[model samples]
Target: MPALDNDTVSKYLERYAEPESTFGARLRRHTDHILVIPAQDEAATLLEGIYPALNAVSVRGERTLCIVVVNATDEARTIVHTNNDHLLQTLTALGPTTPLHTQDETPCWYAEAKGFDLVLVDRNSLGCRLPRGQGVGLARKIGCDIALASLRSGSSRAQLIHMSDCDVQLPSDYFDITVPMSSAAVIYRFHHEPCGNHAIDEAHARYEAYLRYYVLGLRHAGSPYAFHTIGSCIATIPTAYAGVRGVPKRQAGEDFYLLNKLAKLGRIHTARSSPITIRARSSLRVPFGTGRATHDIARNIDAYRIYAPRIFDLLKAWVAALGALDDALPARAYGAVYERASETLDPLDLDRLSQALLTIDAPKALSEAAAHSSLARVRRKWAHDWFDGFRTLKLVHALRDTGLVDIPWQLAITESSFCRSSPTDTGTALIRDRDAFETCRRLARLEERP
Candidate 1:
């Protein structure tokens, strides 16, 4: 569910100073495409990392809108506020400002790049406001809403809002890629930038390895929702954006939740373009992400170990049993599956899942599978819905709580089949055996192409 209300969203969107009537004129009557970047104290990368990359887009006939939401949490101190001020100054200096939209005191300025029109939306401008704790998610939703509004008001038929981050360098042909109409969202290829610092670089490598390992483990468990959820790697259809009620307003994991919802709507494709380069660094922006993982791992390398491989085995068994859900395998039998998946859960708690399955009528609710006049359809649908990524993660935690230990980075690497390296490896040694991580990432790329 969307973490915010329609009234609240409308209010936040109303902060855009440009009237709908003026969107056409500002877009040069050609706002057929848009890119939304949520900036929070990213002045260092905004000019060097993102701007020049955006300048390289050579797509013609499609009017492009680049919306930069310059914002910070309401509780932000001087440093954050100052960085935003500098970012705004840098954007303003990009070219002569042609004002388009304004909310309260924050005016959205129009600046021209080579072939794209830049709309700088400064949330920190005087009188502009947003609730506390509404971070990048809110910034993204606001920018997308503006794009949607502009599309609805103009002659353009733009249907996609490409979401990117300031820390990543976009490909020169970023805009040239097209998403399938049947799909609701697309995740583009991304690789973390390697800074020269050994400690930082090793931490990032381990963190990314963990990220890929989790997704690949889910794939092994037969999850349909197995995919990366990076905010900078996402693009969405306007209808899908509205269908999910826009991105959630959480301090973190907004991408995960948003993609989770979209996955149910339709296929989430992986784009097969040049990978966008995301800079690796320690950041306190949210409760978790690469930055937080990097910070935690640097402090204690073992603190963020991934789920045990056996958990995936248990998950696979549970998922597979869904198809064999005949009278031979009763609801209680399913509980046994959960018990094997995680020894931590008592028979009673595990039995509850069986009861829940019975209540949902097992695979009987799956109509598409019924077309074959077989129970196989029912089993597949039931297993998919019951064992989504969130539920799968929950099961892993239950195991962790019950003494299913997490392995160190090297062990996780071995378990994830990233490499045949010994679990005793540490630091740079573990990172060096990152072939499995890259392999998993490449396999993930197939999802975009398919």
Candidate 2:
């Protein structure tokens, strides 16, 4: 594993680490990579689908440890608890197990597996169930925290804490990519596999297209924080993970927030190898994500709409203007920057841009950025950092809410230069054209070059 600061790792684990489980010195050593999967009510899927897929992963000569955190909230349904019990039991029966650690009534065990060592963390038992609001965020934190602690304890040589869900099939080359030591994290390319159900497949196509379209939009706007924030598609560096104070304990949007913070630390490299095959299925496991998106879209495909392309256009102007802020006079930096940004927009778009900027308080923010640093380059960096991923998303929403209402997904796809280089069919016909929409999704991925 790449070298990490012992101090940072120790500090983070000491203060921000999860309290449920502990990784003692007896934990297996010489691990080359660690993959963390948070499984909740996924017994059959874990045993039949995910397990076989993991065994097929080809990481030669490397001792990989797969840490699966079997978790459920105290308020979870009886079926969830039953599934958790079955999963834990089946895993225990797989091979002879060695006790690792137990704290707060949470039991962690280690067992030899086909292609990787297994560390099964039980957070779903009667006394150890997670609290209602903690959800997957805490589960992920528990698993990743264990991975971090294990790596810090000199038992594991892995630098990256690979994260995925029970619903995805990892690529065989998942652990084979070589990332620069300077990289804060790397996001694996992912494609949601069709379940052969017509309605679900159609919904998956639109939802995946929407995801790609948004990322492509950000890339076109010259945003550095344009990567997808799916927890299943990310692998974070040890030091960078600790630097961000570990993952947030949010019930939803945790992945988005985690990546948003990680992006500020260093480059989030995009892996160009085989894409992870994610199973497209409906679920209400969390508030929102691929599952929820597909579920809703399948029910009301026509009602689903994407942001207007004009919003991205305005965003592009704003990003460009922020980049040019360094050239402005210090005395009237905010005014000069705003004027330059406004000059790029047409008269009708100017008001919308001005209103959106006002909503986000861009003028005061830019002034403060200038006040923070006198050097042109430093001030420019400050501006960009200040307008990070979360704020960029907020800006998009502000523009949408102020005046640029969302257009139909069909119109957005056909009109967005970021999504398509040429115009496509119009109206309801395009919406029903799954092949055409899938083609657009592929194009969007190409345009989102790493």
Candidate 3:
């Protein structure tokens, strides 16, 4: 799961005050959104996930808008004092003040204490304070619910509200990346570090299985359906959030469902151009696949309990600990870093790109990513083939350079004359030669050595 508590974040806060430690590129303008975070008995992971986020958002005393929600069940103060050595050590170093919600009082007190421009939430909030609301959902509905409530109640409908699991360490540039959402659609998606091959492979296989069944099922005919969003990174327009009031609720996931609603309202898009590494680790108590990261140790429901969390957990904590700044950090010193921290976890843009992908003609930039990715694959295959002496050559033929090709080929002038001086038919025959095919055929023989 997420690593560090307030203590760990505190230890890292010094980096912000001293004059720009690492995170880069930020705004010097007045705070724009009233960041709200909903936390629960996640004391074990809070310091690692949110402590830095507060500092990163506040940017020291320079920016003053921040709201945090902690659910200690009926006991709020317990949520505030869950600080232990690890958490304290981190918090002491970070430099922001966290005013917690107290028992017997409503959660709305944050509005008075922080004067937040907007409220952001990460969990532990069915808005028990504002009016009448109470519930729980993650894997799918966690981020979706936060987006709905935060955007619906704000005075002007906040420009943006971010949500994240307490178990994740965010990127330092999280806000920087999402800042653009003030103007358009942005959905944040993390670049996950490699998770356990077994579980991930299993889950991936299951997803594919589902896709196959979905395609094969007699649900509808001639309707194209290719849109998906994960709860971890979804950003919708404030107006859009308000518009989709009656979206269906899933006991486990809300990502795709939320995205479907938003797509109807406006557009859906992915955030950062650069991928932020996300950790994937989980407590055994929380089931995988179905989606809930955490649940009651004794009695719980809704956990897929399929996907392993080890990779995500490690990556999230490392990202938060290193690039994710605390609310305690000075904006003047770590503004850029602060921006990076927020963007790391939450996305700022996705509408345009996501829609384009759905439409099948992605932007030139995304096209390049895929094209270059293919080239990279070719290079890798070539390297493997050459080194293994043709033993590893399944894709080797795909790696051949067009420079060696003839007959109206692009990129060169001196046709077969200056090159191999062979006929076009002969050239094709050489490439598709029986011996060449045999060499590659033998290469695919390499099996996993268990």
Candidate 4:
């Protein structure tokens, strides 16, 4: 096993790091459409993806494109970006590449950058890069903020806007597909797929356990702070997004929240349109509740951790049931976590919220419970939703790199020692596989357009 030392990060950097490969070489890169990827740290994975994703976008046709990185941190910004000359030389080294503008900066700066038409942000930094305020919802809000700023700055118009997590990997044709899929406001239900996860160590197991325990254990479905937003991976029309005003920048569940507000602005359109090929997550770090979000929701009576959808009643359940499960828990007092959550969430807004979840096709059971149950009754059920979160994931990202798949020296990844559980084994593999994905992607392509 590779030691988890500097050597570990280094080894992956040197050997396992995904650079150019035959698979990547063949993939397309589009230059016409601007692909704004707002992320932080994500160096390793970004390095793996940037080139191919660029190539993929370039495939459709040649157009001026930019990969804007709304880098939150200073150090990472320096490493990921280069001055104009260095960037040009790097492009020259890559040989026969199209014009790609890449910029890394803080929120205020990127929002005002020129030609940043399409924006895609990553929420994986919730664990690392961003401070407390800048998470999934915050990221989305920032993107919207930028769009608003651009509009105010008289940048003509900002057309398409998308927010995706670093955990996701985009297909070679996402841009082409997104061109037509951009709607006023929508939540494209993704078929959550899984990636391999066999290398789970003891700590890893506990982490996964925590996710399962926290999400499935509690009952309260939507904490006002539920931040049920899907982090990244949400696409909304630029004007529509700006029209909604702004979304709270919570670290988790940003997608769910944005979708909620978006529904109110215009017709909440749910389409089976062009779907993005996102890869399943590897680490269990960003599960429904990141083991960090907490609050007391029910009039200081109950507490619950909430980060997924339909979490109103579940939050109540956690508050009511905290004591019942306290004796069973071996770790930190679970009830205290609930207490904290209850405190953090905004006051219960049952009538308004219950009506909304139903409109989104949130389970009839949740709606029934919300209407019949008090605020406290629902908050408790959210405690252990992580398990279901894992089990029920639908759409997944695409796999763009080809570094460790065929290395002669068993370079240790998909076929290794503790490769415990992955999105594939959890059952969404076939759905996200290249062949399956191609089939799915083809479904979006009309009978005529190639």
Top lDDT prediction, candidate number: 2
TM-score of 1: 0.78
Per-residue CA lDDT of model 4 for 44-136, tens digit only, reads 344344345446544453432333333342233444433322432332333333322223322111121122222323222322245544544
By how many angstroms RMSD does model 4 differ from the true structure?
A: 18.7
For candidate 1, give the lDDT of residue 252: 81
Q: Provide C-alpha RMSD values for all models, in order.
A: 6.7, 2.6, 22.4, 18.7
lDDT of 3: 0.32
Worst 10 residues of 2 by lDDT: 421-430
Give stretches of model 2 more than 4 Å off.
47-59, 102-104, 327-331, 422-437, 448-450
The TM-scores, one per candidate, come to 0.78, 0.93, 0.39, 0.40
Residue 362, candidate 1: Cα error in Å is 11
Each prediction's Cα lDDT score? 0.65, 0.80, 0.32, 0.35
Q: Tell me the lDDT of candidate 2.
A: 0.80
For model 3, what is the alpha-carbon lDDT of residue 151? 30
lDDT of 3 by residue, 1-450 (tens): 111123322333322111111110111224444343434444545535544444555564423243334432223343333532233333223343332334532332222223222222223333332111232232223233333333332322235545455545556555555433323245654433424554543333223222222221111111112222444454445444444542233332344455554544344555553333344433331233322332121123222222111212222322232222222122221233334434533332222212222333213322233333335444333222222211111111211221111122111111111112233432332244243222222211211000
Which regions of candidate 3 are displaced past 4 Å? 1-30, 34-41, 47-68, 71-135, 138-158, 177-185, 194-225, 246-250, 283-450
Sort by TM-score, best first.
2, 1, 4, 3
